[model samples]
Target: MNQQNHFALGLITLIIFLFLLGPLAIIFVASFEPTSVLQFPPTGFSLEWYRNIFTVSAFMDTFKLSMFISFLGNLCALLLGIPAAYALSRFDFRGKGLLNAIFVSPILIPGTVLGFTFLRYLIVSYSLPLEAALFIGHTILMLPFIIRVIASSMANFDFSIEEAAMNLGSSRIGAFFRVIIPNIKSGIIAGVLIAFLESFNNVDISVFLTGPGLSTLPIQMLTYVEHYFDPTVAAISVLLMIFTAVFMFLIERLVGLSHFTKR
Candidate 1:
């Protein structure tokens, strides 16, 4: 019976892995197809679609925009979230629950609703630029992840370290920078990478926020698929998969991925 149970568990695990990775495997293989259209079991293989990704001006432009928004939005989220997380973890304050709820509300809300709300209240009412709106929207979307991750990292932290630093002539701010920040470095890095990934791959919010002369790579990919059907998008997807895998691998190397699961 134990052997039978083990076989069943192994079968389920194999199925789960295939379910997650099947489409990506298909895309990777289809990307090398010589033909313009994406298809499985290619008759011929070539790098044409991959080369086409670079030649397309829209892809290039939006790729840069996506990178810019992702990096900057994650940066802003970290700047704000670190302090916010520290406060929530360390201090007792009135409305702390309410503030925590507000911080996390973005992730809880559906992306479509969040996007429309931002469009109506933040963009239309304030008359903000598309770039500014995109930045703000992405920043908000990133806040929950950043705050939660950093706060989780701080859950097991020893406050006495900060107290000791303060006792040794470090100001509260200096102690935070020198002591607290270093202790939570792993979480901070993980949060930034996760936030960057979210902001970069965002579509529902970005679709609403984008306008002429401003677009993200995911948005561009959507628009591209609307006008054309080809392996170019597949090639792009494959490249993005590689990029994300590399990014996560680096994060794991810098700070073991287990850090997130632990605290």
Candidate 2:
């Protein structure tokens, strides 16, 4: 009976994997089509789309734009989120619970609404640039995830260690840098990775924040698909999947995925 159950579970997993990955496989295969139109079956294989990607300034620019936005957005979220997480984990204060809830509320908001709200705030109130709008939206959207991850780590951390370091004549800042930071490194890495992924793949928030002058890769793909029904977007998607998978593998090796689980 046990062996039969194991076989059934294995078959279930295989079916699920195929369901999820079959479309991805199709995207990759379609990317190599020689024809201009996006179709599954092709006349022949060609590298023209891949080659043209290098020469396409719009594609290159959007790729860089996405990378730059995710980087800066995650950095800003780290700065804002660490303090908030530490506060929640290490102290008791008036309205502490409320503050925590408010900080993470962005995650609950519909991306479309959040995007439009920030876009309105930036455009009408602050009159900020496109890049600033995107960064602010992404940073806020990712802040909760970072804070939650860090707070979970800090919850498991022993404050006595921090106290001991301080009692030994280490300054508060020194203790933080030496003891606290090292202890929370895994959580920090996880937060940063999650933040980057959120920023990188965001479409709804980005769509509202984007201006006519600037476009992100996802938005650019959307724009292209509206006018041109080509498989270039599929090719780009394949490249991004490869890059993301490689990075995730590296992250898994660096910090086991189990580390994110609550203790």
Candidate 3:
């Protein structure tokens, strides 16, 4: 009976994995198709489409813009989120629950609603530039994720060590910098990865925030698909997959992906 149950679970896992990976497998093959249209079972294979992505000026600029926004906005999120998470984990303060709910509320809201709110609040009210609008929006969206990840790590942390340090010679701030931060390094790294990806791939928020000169790569890809139907996008998708794989590989190497997976 146990053997049968184990077999059933294994079969279920295989089916789910295949279901998720099937489309990605098709796209990987489609990207190499020499013809213009994206199709399975290509007549021939060529690197032409991959080469074509670079020739498009907007793709290059938009890619750079996406990377910049994702990295910088995530950095700001970490700067704000780490301290916020630490405080929430360590201290008792007035309105702590309310503040925690507010900090994490964005994760519960739909991205489209948040985007519209930002447009009305920042652009219409404050007349902020597109760049600033996007940066701030991404940072806000990132905060909840960063806070959650780091906060989980903090929960498992041994606060006694920090207290011991403080009882000795270290100031509270010094104890945090020297001991607490090092202990939670895995969570910080995980948060950085998750936040950067969210910022890069976000569409609903970025759609409203984009202006005349500034557009994220995902939005740019949408616009490209509207005017053109070809394997160029597939090629781009393959490249993004490769980029994501490399990033994940590095994350696994540095901190072990299990850090994020474990409760």
- Tell me, by TM-score, which candidate is best: 1
In candidate 1, clashing pairs total: 0
TM-score (C-alpha) between model 2 and the true structure: 0.91
Each candidate structure's count of clashing pairs: 0, 0, 0
State the lDDT of candidate 3 residue by residue for 27-59, as single tens digits: 999889998887897779999999999999999
Ranking by TM-score: 1, 3, 2
For 60-134, candidate 1 gives per-residue lDDT tens digits of 999999999999899899999999999999999999999999999999999999999999977899999999999
Error of 1 at 27 (Å): 0.6
Tens digits of per-residue lDDT for model 2 on 4-116?
99999999999999999999999999999888998996668987788877787888899899999889888888999998899899999999989988997888888889888
Q: Could you estimate the TM-score for every candidate?
A: 0.95, 0.91, 0.92
Model 3: CA > 4 A from native: 1-9, 253-263
| TM-score of candidate 3 to 2 decimals | 0.92
- Backbone clashes, candidate 3: 0
